[model samples]
Target: MSRPRDLYDDYTPSQQMTDAIKAWEDIVEQEKEVRRAAREAIAAELRDARVERDGVEHRVSQEAVARYVPWSEATVLGIAREYKVPGVRQAKKKAADAG
Candidate 1:
C-alpha cells in the first residue's frame, strides 16, 4: 500500500517550512478549541440529563424505576408521576384538608 502523504514531511527548516508549521499550529489550535467546545456542549447535555433523571427519581422510587426501564420515555415518565416516591415533598395542601 502507498504511504499517506505527511503534511509535515522532513525538510530543511526554512521560512516556507516555518510558515507551514505556523499554519499547521493554527489548525491544531483551532481543532483544540473545537474539541473543547464539543466537550463543553456534551458536559452541559449530560448535566441536563442527570438533572432530569434525578427529577424523575425524586418523583418515583429509585429502586422501582429500574424495573420500568425499556419502556418508552413518556410511559416511564407517566409511571414515575403515578407512583410517588416516599419522603419527597409537594406543596402544602390547604388547611381544610389538614384536619
Candidate 2:
C-alpha cells in the first residue's frame, strides 16, 4: 500500500496560524475560569448540603454530591476540601439534632 500525501507535510507558520492559536488559548482560559466557578459553586452547595435520614438531617455524603455533579466522588471531595467545606475532613456521626 502507498502512503497518502499529507496536506501539511511542509507546513510553515503563518499569521492565520498565530491568530488561530491565540483564539484557542483564549477559549482554554475561558474554559478554565468557567470550571473554577463551577467548582466554587459546587463547594458552596456542599457546605450547606443536607439530607434527612431516619427523621434527622445529616450532611450530604460525598457519594451523593458525586451523583449530583458531573465529576467523580474523589473529585467532589477534593473540591470540597479545597474550599474548606465542612464534613470533608471528618463526617459527623451524630444526628444534627443530637447536640
**Strongest candidate by TM-score:** 2
Question: Which residue runs of candidate 2 sit more than 4 Å off their true CA positions?
Answer: 1-12, 88-99
Cα error, candidate 1, residue 38 (Å): 0.5
TM-score of 1: 0.37
- Name the candidate that leads on lDDT: 2
The Cα local distance difference test for each model comes to 0.52, 0.84
lDDT of 1 by residue, 11-96 (tens): 56789889999999999999999866654443333233332442553233333343544445454444445443232245466889
lDDT of 1: 0.52
RMSD of each: 13.7, 6.5
TM-score to true structure, per model: 0.37, 0.69
Model 1 clashing residue pairs (backbone): none
- Candidate 2 clashes: the total is 0
Q: lDDT tens digits, residues 1-99, model 2? A: 999978996877899999999999999999999999999988878888777768967777777778978899999989988998866444456686575
